[model samples]
Target chain A: MDVVVDNLGVFGRGLLVSIQISAATFVLAGLLGVLLTVCRISPVLPLRLAATGYVELVRSLPLLVLLTLFVFGLPEIGLIGPLLWTAVAAMSLYWATFFSETLRAGVRGVPLGQIEAARAIGCTFGQVLTQVVLPQAVRTSIQPLASLLIAVILNSSLAAAVGVTQELTGQTQLLDQRYAQPLVTFGAAAACYVALAFVIGRSAGILDRRLAVQR
Target chain B: MTVTTEAPVQRRPLTVRLGSIGQQDAALFDVPGPQAQRRIAIATALSSLALLALVALAVRQFAINGQLEWDKWQLFTQWPVLRYLAIGLLATLQVTVVSGALALPLGALLALARLSRSPLLNRPAALYIEVLRAIPLLLLIYAFLLGLPTTGLRIPLFWQLIIPIVLTNSAVLAEIFRSAVKALPQGQTEAALAVGMGYWQTMRLVVLPQAIRMAAPALVSQVIRLLKDSTLGYVVSYLELLYSAKVLGEFNHTIIQSYVVVAVVFVIANLTLAAVAGQVERRFVGRAHRT
Candidate 1:
């Protein structure tokens, strides 16, 4: 307990950084995912194939590899950036592929009649997508999207590998190295992650319930 | 009131305009007009050129760094580098296989406990699953790797990686098995009981076998996840594939090249497993449909 109190500054900073990364990655990846989903599921053959190719190629490799490339390989091509942005980019690129798939699933969950009704009512493709399709798609996709965000939080731990020292796992490493109290420090760090996961699950559940009630 | 209100809505057929059954066009839009076609063609050409430029840049960088040299890659075929990577691969395989083997039985027990009538068993099982699922695998590994030695356990390094993987994965597998069991029609369990088989007997002979079969694809995916998770071993100074690649990179001063090779190996291994799992899934689903 004393150890935890003394190290609060370090661990708290780490947790804050982890949360920031998760939030940033969540928003960026979600937008990219929606774009990719539209491309993958669009009528344009080339766009669909291109989106498919990108998702498959990126998803096949581990996040670690992508992080390595972003950290080491990006600078070689003059796309130099800070470690934080590069980590976020790598994560967003990896996660967007998954988000697109989940969104696709949600789109599939929408009833065919809903789309047909929208179209018959003289909605254009874009109108139907934005007004009729996307709302229902997002609602249905909430659970999976919640899971994906949780995954983002977990994967952000990998950002520590590339010298993102402000994050939870990174702080754990720092503290562990200085104090050699892996059990106490890492335990506290794990507790932070577990607590965050619980919060995510509860919020997602609450949202799911609210939506259910509305329906 | 809410339950009654939801009943009718639940009965609606959920078939949306999913992509066409065969050769799914993931693209959701309709046929393009002539103008739209030209725009698409332009977009495609531009995107292709952009992709080509990126590849070209990477190639040029590799050339500049002297990583493209034939002699550099000879490291892969040589005695020491090849042996190191091979040993790392073997280490990863060992942990994946051993941990997976142990987790299965433990997971099965956990599933059974959760499904059992006793509140005591169900309560702990639920907590275990939720808690383990919440914590990241890396954190779990870190705690055990760094924490346990202080407690005077002093176990061998082999058990260190194995213990965390097994604990976390077993919890996941438990949930999978529980869901699989729940998915088995309730009538099946009742029918087995109607024949006077004991609870354990029914689970072992009737429910479990069917549930395991139902969950095999998901189980295989979990195994693939474990294979990926094993790479976290590098953090603990375990000579796994990623760590081995880092070592070779440092030795050869070709970190990017070394990492690329490692990534290729991981991709091939994981992709093969996924392909095999897909085949098994298709065959099983096909049989289920036919019967």
Candidate 2:
């Protein structure tokens, strides 16, 4: 208890890094997700095949393996340098796969007639996509996207494997090492994580309500 | 609620939009047109260009390194720890399979409970879903792994992490399924009840079949999640595949190769499960369509 209280700032910094990683990954992956979802149903056989293959690849592997690869492998080949990039890239890759699926579901929900109506109004392909397709897709998908972001937040703990110092999970270990009481340190960390989760979940509910009212 | 004798109105067919189906498809590589030979020539040129680029990169890497390092892949096949990795991977599979099996029944129970007419059961089910939906899985993992042991419950290391995972996962899946079950027309249950069927009998013989069919895709996805969540066992110090990869990286200084192999293994395991899920979904959908 004394150790956790003493090292509160250190632990708070780790929690912030986790939030930063998850926030960035959520935004980037959401966009990438829509793109891949479009690709999955692409009229082009090769494109559809490639998109399917990519999603399959992402879903199968453990996040720990992927993160380990980023930290240990990319630097060896001169692809990455700083340790945070490793965590960010791996987190983005993992979340993007999930976000893509959710985005695809959103895309699938958009009525076929709405899209046709937009094109008949002489909208360009890009305009129709940006104005008509994506707008509604995003609306229908907020709930699922919220869920995926929560997952991104959770999986950020895996980044500890790649030497991203001071994550919620990692700091627990740190406190355990210094304080020699895994019980108190880990329990405190667990409570913090759950509290964060409760907030995210409630925020998502408020978003869901706002969207419903707008509709 | 009035039955209509009038035939449905038929609308004219509308143009197919690009997002729905691009005039060519998303990225459009198919050229099965009359100018087939010309298209083939373009495709062939593109392939050769890509091949050349890959070879050039390999050549540069080989010249710089004096070898492709391709021979180093043998670490996967011929290591003293290879057996341990296999054991760890099997443990990973066992955990995933067992957790999923446990989750399915519990998920169904909670889903059914949510649908119960009694407010006591339904409201608590709602609360459970709300709480589990909000929290991250890692928090649950920490709770089961670290918190439970402190309580002197004394669970095995393997089951320690697995319990929280199953609990949380089943809760979400319960929501997925309950939503699907509730989405159906109320007339199905009404019809059964009007025919003097008990609530349990109606649920057992009627509601479940339809709900399961509708929830096929989600069920498949939850299974994939279980497979991935099995890796979180590493955080709890359980010897899953990812933990084994970490061990190899820490020991051999060959972290890249070891982790890549684990990634490939993960991809393979996921793809295999996905394939099975696909087959099951198709079978169920096909039967639904027929009936």
Best-matching candidate per lDDT: 1
Q: Give residue A107's lDDT in candidate 2 (0 to 100).
A: 72
lDDT of 2 by residue, A49-83 (tens): 45666787876777776777777776655565768
Which stretches of model 1 miss by more than 4 angstroms? A72-80, A179-181, A213-215, B1-27, B61-67, B77-80, B194-197, B284-291
Highest-scoring model, DockQ? 2
Q: Which ten residues in a row have the lowest lDDT in candidate 1 chain B?
A: B14-23
Could you tell me the interface RMSD of model 1? 3.9
Clashes of each: 5, 2
* Candidate 2 Cα misplacement greater than 4 A, ranges: A1-12, A34-52, A78-80, A173-215, B1-67, B79-84, B117-120, B288-291
| Model 1 lDDT per residue over A62-181, tens place | 787778767876665456788899999999998999988898889888788778788788888889889988888878888898899998998899888777878999889778878888
The top-ranked prediction according to TM-score is: 1
- In order, the B-chain TM-scores come to 0.83, 0.77
Supply the global lDDT for candidate 2: 0.75
